[model samples]
Target: MNDELSLPATELVRRTLAHAKRLLPAALFHHSVRTYLYGRLLGEQRGLRPGRDYDDELLFLGCVLHDCGLSAEGDGDQRFELDGADLAVRFLEGEGVASDRAQVVWDAIALHMDREIAERKRPEIALVALGAGFDLGGGPERLPPGYTDRVHRVLPRLHAAAVLHDSIVRQALENPRKAPPFTMQGELVRQATGGSWPTWEHLARSAGWNDYEGYRP
Candidate 1:
């Protein structure tokens, strides 16, 4: 709830929820949110802090909107990530965020799922890595020789990323800024379940949500 980070956070949530409604399966909206939440937690546990060299505002905004494009055309694929990044860039630009800052968010979204981006070790790339728990792949020990030295300079920003992730997820769920789109499948699920939503664990077991196994945070 840092006021400094609130503006971008709000915009990111607003856009993401809207996108989710339009593009995600009604049954998958909750799961998608949970995946985001888990990603935040994983980032935190791995020592990814927020608000340091880079703006925590940018990091928070980017992380929340990172997966929004998944619903742009209604599927989970790399294209979704690309679309989401484009959407975020456009939104931030419209908001008059400095072009540089907007680019940071853009880069973060583009690289969140691409590890090679991390290996390149740019500060922006590192911020995205920390925000998405990308470093959790091979553990700290597996990092290239100079990885620690490079990231050390940006540790505080990393921490800010982690904190922003936690804050955004809490706000989104506790008081969802927007709801999933109304669709036949979503409506049917809602009606059949009496408005009850399944937990991530339940969805994982019943709907084959195993891609994230051992990576949940």
Candidate 2:
């Protein structure tokens, strides 16, 4: 499925990936790729067609760059989602992408954490949150049969839930702005600091995957 809907990487996608690789961790980067794959699958499930309902390249960019805030280059005195969005937009500017397209990716990354709001937006934005939710144990029965095993065989999960959750908690601890109250990062930070949230560790233990080896406690 590396064909990405039977299309090769456009120049923009190539540039986006190159930039993202410089910022994202290996595990997170792979998660980003899987996000695109899963998002595409979910779109197809909902009868949405790429290049018609939305731009496929934009979807790819949004999914891959959605976590840039977790990277040092993208870190800032703001929520990770916002920071990540800003960083992605800036990178897009460097690639000479139009402002409107860049804004789509911005909204996708920034709102991917908000199910209610994101689901109300355009597919370009909404699909991102849905896909991320799916990857994190939502709608497991809805995914196509054997899809997880197939994609994961090519690109390992690397315990993405555990990795992503802990990264947010750690960064939020170091810089409080990154985990402002009411956000997921704030909840994760609280969890790591003896408070509790229904965290990825909880999800992983309950997921029955029996393959979680990241982030203890």
Candidate 3:
């Protein structure tokens, strides 16, 4: 990793995933981590570079910490974003980032899932929110009327997002333990899926186990 860009984002994401591993269902952990990474990759693709006004280190840290609240409970409430944002505000403030920049991170978290908020915020935060929305597959239906036209102007970014999403899904399948069993094999199929059995088969296939036929779910 380049020292100038600093690998803080990756490191922070790794640490956050590790921490979630100990507490969350494998599927949920994988989903959340992938979602965060998707946001980061999408942001980069969009040319929405993090400005010097905020430390890249802090931005990465904020991105990694952005979804921690989801681990606290299992619900689709947008409040999860707010909880994560509040946590980031405190964490970044302690890390010596200015209040204004910290607020940028907080606002990003708060509005990540809400396009209406994106329309009303600073460009920096709006960029982050755009990435988050894209990660959730928020098509033009979720955006305001003219937003899609504006976003279409950035073709490369959209292409990058599609590629990144595919990569993340492949990685998740390769490591079944990282994803919820149900996600890998729907709830109806979990019983037929076989706990560690499916995981082993997945690992084997990933490890080139073409002839190793075993129970598959």
Candidate number with greatest lDDT: 2
Q: Point to the candidate with the largest TM-score.
A: 2
- The reply for model 1, stretches above 4 Å from the true place, is 1-48, 73-78, 122-124, 127-217
| Residue-pair clash count for candidate 3 | 2
For model 3, which pairs clash?
27-179, 27-180
Model 1 lDDT per residue over 144-198, tens place: 4554344433232334333333433333333232223242233333553468666
Q: lDDT tens digits, residues 158-177, model 3?
A: 34344433433433344433
lDDT scores in order: 0.49, 0.84, 0.50
- Candidate 3: Cα lDDT at 63: 49
Q: Which stretches of candidate 2 lie over 4 Å from their true place?
A: 1-8, 195-217
Model 1: per-residue Cα lDDT at residue 198: 64
State how far residue 9 of model 2 sits from its true place (Å).
2.4
What is the alpha-carbon RMSD of candidate 1 to the true structure?
14.7
Model 2 lDDT tens row, 152-209:
8877888888899988987888898888655778878876787655666677788888
Off by over 4 Å in 3: 1-29, 50-55, 73-78, 138-217
